[model samples]
Target: MWSDHAPLTIQLTSPLHKPKTMTWRLHENLLSNPQVAQDIQQALTNYFAENLPQDTSPLLTWEAHKCVIRGILISHSSALKKAQEHTIRELTAKIGTLTQAHKRTLDDTLLRELTAAREELARVLRQS
Candidate 1:
């Protein structure tokens, strides 16, 4: 006699373990911003001035300086990204509103405005 239930097979395997490493690269576009350049210069100047003590090793100071520069770049990059996102959102909303108005009246002025807004939005999206 055979049972109605089918046989089941289960396979078990160990999970793979790998070390996680983080790599950060600077966005070259940020260099074009005058504010970022100024902020980096100020941070380097302060780091050097404060670490001028004779007891500090040059190698350690150099390493620490790298960290300081990284921090500045990261902060500026984050801020820039946030601002770009905000602009993109606003442009999207403006485009939506203008498109609706243009559709309702089919006015030449509204059409022109909507076209301009769409172009602006495209530009902002490309930058981000």
Candidate 2:
């Protein structure tokens, strides 16, 4: 039972056996914008601090960071979209009002021109 050609029974399961993982940290620039930075920090502290898994594996950490970034982008995009929509509505209303005024003025001018032409034709007919 103790053959010289037998394989080793030990199995590797330590961190050393695994490949070096990418470790990431928040950059200093995250603090550059005071207001946004504060919001990010607060959210990070509350969510990342409290909600992250205890494992902290490289893949999980990377995914968590991506989720946070995605959330921030979504929030910013939503706010920007609202502002754009509001500006569009205001411009559309102003344009409509101007167009209506132009149409009315144009109608009045056409009416005056037609009336003058009719008067000229009546005088010509009476002279003949």
Candidate 3:
């Protein structure tokens, strides 16, 4: 029998509500397995260093569906170039990790997505 006078203390928590950044890293960490979060973080940092523009905030807000690369290139201030490069590298590394995991039997849909994403990154870099 359920006690009517019992103190109802309920502690509620849900796993799905974790922040996107944490979740993003979580997926990668799980795939990579046993590596510390800092290792993943460092890998992402290195990837950014190699492929992205010096400034990438503009790219984040830039609409791929509506915006043309040429216009974006012309509009971005020189200061943002580094950020853009960094973003491209980071994004590429993250996507590439997933794409490479399957290797010989790569998922067609995922490959297309990564290819499109890389092209977008290149376009942003190519912008004059």
Candidate 4:
């Protein structure tokens, strides 16, 4: 009974539960890319050509088609994101180098190049 520390107790009033459902969505920007559009179009055509003659239910075929298209979109979107991130990193480095050069020379040409690079970086960032 000589302990100086106080005892602590914790209690939960209700049981915690995790959400049971997840929603999947396509990135609309991916659709705007011509290569992605062509790939999806080709996938849909192939899917129907191979499966349309089957006796499977229409609902099942539709669901399966959705899964196929989702895979394509996800892959293409991830690749595009990677490329954009690479471009962003390159632009950032170029800007940093140009800033250092401009600081030393104060040349108009370097200033213009730096400005252009900054604008390009901003455009890429906005797309991402």
Candidate 5:
């Protein structure tokens, strides 16, 4: 085993690497769940399309969140309900304007939107 001709295996490590995880086995008898899948795919595509940086690598990647929105979108969260009834449609329409906005302006506007959305979500979460 120590001979020069022997093959070697090496493990790679990264200081920032997190452990792998397992999630819900959603496919279990959910073969007919195409609507749920379509909703998630549409939301994910919208998120990526809207948020991807123009020319450089993005600071955040969708994979980093591991599709957390799937649970959020499906849950009976008051935040989701309230947002749909309140600002969501307006925000969605505003997305098209980002193309003409300056980067700094976009950043500030988006951060404000994110904070508002988060507060609403947190309020609903606390209630439940």
Candidate 6:
């Protein structure tokens, strides 16, 4: 039976959703490229080896070496990415200036050099 006024009811069985996982995927070539991957791995290993204690207990030395190596790897990776960004920015600025030149523009040699720099940047970005 319905009454003149009735209270409302609400129910929720589940909470709002969010992404299950977040990922930053690098290029397949970055991982699949043996040379680059090997180089990175070898560098990390060398870093650990160099920092490891020569005549000390394994446990403490291993832990310390691992921490240092991890820090170095993270810093190195960030540095590489930053360097790439800087190179690209520099290339872009050079190209923009050349393209926006006045009637009395750059000479042939300067124009060619600018073009070459841009092309080199493109090549590096593609490889990365």
Cα lDDT computed for each candidate against the true fold: 0.89, 0.62, 0.55, 0.92, 0.56, 0.69
Residue pairs with colliding backbones in model 2 are none
Tens digits of per-residue lDDT for model 1, 1-128: 97998898998665885657989998998889899999999998999999985869999999999999999999998988899899888988998998898889999999898899889988888877
Candidate 6, 1-128: lDDT as tens digits: 76887688998556665647955444444455566667668866886676566766778777776665455455556667798898888888877777666225757876787778778878978956
Residue 81 in model 3: shift from native, Å? 2.0
User: Per-residue lDDT for 122 in model 1?
Assistant: 88
TM-score computed on alpha carbons, candidate 6: 0.48
Error of 5 at 88 (Å): 35
TM-score for every candidate vs. truth?
0.80, 0.44, 0.33, 0.76, 0.29, 0.48
Distance (Å) between predicted and true CA of 122, model 3? 1.4
Quote model 4's TM-score. 0.76
Question: For residues 1-128, what per-residue lDDT tens digits would candidate 2 score against the true structure?
Answer: 66788676987687767677965544444346576667767777786666567767767776787788657755755565576566556645654555566567867665555455455545544533
Positional deviation of residue 72's Cα in model 4 after best superposition, in angstroms? 0.9
Best by TM-score: 1
Candidate 6, residue 2: how far the Cα is off, in Å: 25
RMSD of 3: 20.2
Off by over 4 Å in 2: 1-35, 51-53, 102-128
Q: Residue 54 CA error for candidate 4 (Å)?
A: 3.1
Worst window of 10 by summed lDDT in candidate 6? 22-31
Better of 3 and 5 by TM-score: 3
Candidate 3 lDDT over residue span 1-128, tens digit each: 77779688998879777655621111222334333334445555665565455555546534431233323233333235567778778878866775776475778877887787777867866752
RMSD of each: 7.2, 23.1, 20.2, 6.3, 19.0, 8.4
The regions of model 3 sitting more than 4 angstroms off are 1-78
